[model samples]
Structure formats: C-alpha cells, structure tokens
Target: MERLKQITSLASLAVFRELYNSQTDIYAIISRFLNEIISTNGKYNFTLTEITNLLNDSFGFTIPEAVVSTSLGRLDHITKERDIFSVDKEFERTSNDVSSLKDMSLQKSSDIVDGLINYIEKKKTYV
Candidate 1:
C-alpha cells in the first residue's frame, strides 16, 4: 500500500509538471507566432482557427480550439473583432532577449496551472 501510494503521488506530480510545461510551450509558441506575423506584415490579423491550425501543425499535436482561444484571450495585445483577432500595432517586441520571453511564459504557465487547481478544488467542494 505504501509503495502504491508513493507511485501514485509521483505520477500525479509528473502529470502536473507536464501540464505546466505544455502550457508554457503553448504560450511561447503563440507569442512567437504573433511576433512573426507582425514582423513580416507590420500587422497581425488572424482568427482562432488560424492560430489553432498553426499550433497543431507546428507541434504535430491536436490542440483544442478552446485552449488556443483562452491563451489568446490572456494576451494583452490581442484584440477580438467578431471572429477575427488582431494584435496591437504598437506592441512590438523591444528586446531580443529569449530569457525574458521564457520567464514571462513560465509565469503565465504557472498562473494557468494554479487557476486550474483552484477551479478543481472549488468544484470538489460543491460535489
């Protein structure tokens, strides 16, 4: 029983870690994707479907549309007009520091993970 409990706890931790890492990756991908669009075109005009397709193609993994939408919504520069989304023209990246982008992505990922945990806990209490 003790060994099983230990394994279960470790497995849970691993799952949580993967979830956090994946969220971080998602944020980084979306950031870079938007940056590429803005840099190449001087502006960004896209839709959720486009973003979702890009993510899926880049990662070769099926990412849910809701996940993409939620991530985009969290970004300050992204604005929605009906079905289309655009980035603020003035929101250009000022620094080429990869570390800063990673740090920001990690922080955002942590917040997302914490929110998910809190949401689950809240729902558990009601159940």
Candidate 2:
C-alpha cells in the first residue's frame, strides 16, 4: 500500500518526530493495551509479531519486529527483558541448571547461574 511505502521509506527518527508532532494515537493505543495486559496478566504477554501486526494495521506503520521488541522497554509502561522465553521451558532450564533439584533455593540457584555467566563473560572464556 501507499502507507506501507511511506512508513518503510522514512527513517524511524523522522517518522517518530512526524508522529509526535502530528499525533500520538499510536503511542496512546499501545500504552493502553500494555496497561490492560499488565492489569489482567501482570506482565507483557504479547509477542513481537502480534505487536508488529497491530502497529502495521492500527498505526499504519511498517514496524520492524526488532523495533517492537525493543520499543516496549523504552516505554516506561511495559516491562521488557532482553528476550522472550517459554515459562515452562525456562523453569525446566533453571531446574536443570540447579542439578535437577526442585528443593534448592531458587534465589541461590539464580545467583550461582548469574555469577557463572558473568564470570565467563568477564574472563572472555569463549570456545
């Protein structure tokens, strides 16, 4: 569509400035949806693809998936982490890291993992 061409052609900063100067409907809608998600689910549950589609249709912007993933964190309303993960899979991963023991202190296990990962990065111990 013509709108898609416009959105994709313009640099994001220019688009943002134009959007900000002209209208904030996109931001308002996104913020409202994020608030609703938090009030009902307690955290961001929408995937990047979902948000991308929403923005493309509602705001008429050809938003990139990476931008949506990062933009949520930029907004104070949405809590964003580095990446998305399956909750069940994450639990299994953490449990496995903790020697397959469910009784271990979760905090302690997390700390250990954090420390090991940080140490590796700090020392540049890469394969």
Candidate 3:
C-alpha cells in the first residue's frame, strides 16, 4: 500500500510536469517563471536582456528582449526600475489564489488520488 501511494504520487507529478511543459502562452509562461524565481530567491530583479536569456535557456524559446519588455509592461504585478524589473509582493499574494485551468486540473487529480488512497486505507482497516 505504501508503494502504491508512492507510485500514485510519482504518476501525478509526472502528469503535472507534462501539462506544464505543454503550456504555450508566452505571458503565462513568463509570469510563472518569474513567480518561481521570486519564490526561490525572495525577489525578482532582472533586466530585459537577462530575462530574455533566461527564458530562452529555460524554455528553449528565442524570445526577443522587446517582447520581454512588453510583457513586463503588461503585467500589473511587475514594476520597472531603470533597467531592472521586479514583482509586487501584494499582487503576488493575490495572484496565488487565482487558479488557471491547468492548476485546477492538477489539483483535482491530486484530490482524487488522495481520496482513493484514503478509501483503500479504510478498507484495509475493516478487513
């Protein structure tokens, strides 16, 4: 049963990674990447050139610096200072509550797996 639970968890994680990789929206992709950076580093501070380079290396997408600048301008949660861009802490907290379909699906899958595991455990106790 423990092995089964581990397998299920690994499978769900693989599915989430597949879904994440299949995502195409440049804006969402950039936003998600920025959010990850902020989460890891405690702040997001990168110039257009740096952002473009990182995105290209991370996503294998040859995004132009101009496009990165435009995306930074469009996002309300991002602020510009000279050549650096940073995320708004307040907006970041708010945005965490906003679920895209991808997030919803991943969450639903996790819930279903957890429910199944619980049900199985209950059955074992009865037996």
Candidate 4:
C-alpha cells in the first residue's frame, strides 16, 4: 500500500524524532507498560504468544502473528540481540537481559508507538 511505502522510505532518525516529539502522556503510558514487564531485577521473559496477549490486553489491538513476527524481526535488528526465540513450536523472547526487555516493552507502549515506528523504519534501512 501507499502508506507502507511511505513508512518504508522514512529514515530511522526521522522516525525516532517523530516519536520523541509525541505527547508526554504517551511516553508515560509506554513507560508504565515497560515497567509491568520488568521482573524482580527489571527483566522479563516472554514467548510470542505471551507478548501477543500482553499487547492485546494493554493496547486493545489484535496484532496478527505476521505483524508480531515483523515487529520482532525489526526489534532484533535494532537491538542486535537475539531477543526473539523459537521454543518447542512457538517464538519467544526469554532472555533475562532486563534492560533490553524494558526497551522492547517500552517501544510497544502506546506512548512510544512513534518511536517503535521509527525503529522499524530505521531497521528497514539497515536491512
């Protein structure tokens, strides 16, 4: 679609800047979402299904498996960590890397939606 192409053409910096300039309350919401994922040491371990359920509950969106897959791929590209995993027969992110998990969760928060969009846009550039 035209929108997808437009999104694809955007640079990562542009994407991040757009996200950073978004409303403050958005960031707060995102931060809260990220905080929820934080374990005792500020980390989380989630399988793809778990993430999908969490996102559905938090954002009220039905994120398709392909979409989640693409998002995970983009996140992996930017973070340069194998946060996405394949377990038994499902995809997952089970690392105890607290900071990374926080970042990913934050990125998925409504407040940081723009940032995540930017991250994905930028990730496309690198690929």
User: Which residue runs of candidate 1 sit more than 4 Å off their true CA positions?
Assistant: 1-43, 93-127
State which candidate, 1 or 4, has the greater lDDT: 1
lDDT by residue for model 3 (29-103), tens: 556544544444455577778767765543334567777777667678788988888877675442331124334
Q: What does candidate 4's lDDT look like per residue over 1-127, in tens digits? A: 5433333323222433444566454334333333333322223455556665664444334556555545544432122125543322232433333334334444445345567779999999999
**Which window of 10 residues has the lowest lDDT sum in candidate 2?**
91-100
Give the alpha carbon lDDT tens digit for every residue of 25-119 in model 2.
66543433333323334333556676566555543456677655555555554444454411222221111211212113333445555697799
- With a 3 Å backbone cut-off (N, CA, C), the pairs that clash in candidate 3 are none
After aligning candidate 2 to the native by TM-score, how far in Å is the CA of 43 from where it should be?
A: 10
What local distance difference test score does each model get? 0.59, 0.44, 0.59, 0.43
**Worst 10-residue stretch by lDDT in candidate 3?**
93-102
Counted clashes in each candidate structure: 0, 0, 0, 1
Predicted structure 3, TM vs. truth: 0.44
Top model by TM-score, which number? Answer: 1
Could you tell me how far off, in angstroms, the CA of residue 92 lies in candidate 3 after the best superposition? 3.0
Candidate achieving higher TM-score, 1 or 4: 1
Query: How far off is residue 101 in model 1, in Å?
Result: 11
Better of 1 and 2 by lDDT: 1
User: Of the pair 2 and 4, which is ahead by TM-score?
Assistant: 2
lDDT of 4 at 35: 34
List all candidate RMSDs to the true structure.
14.1, 20.1, 8.8, 16.3
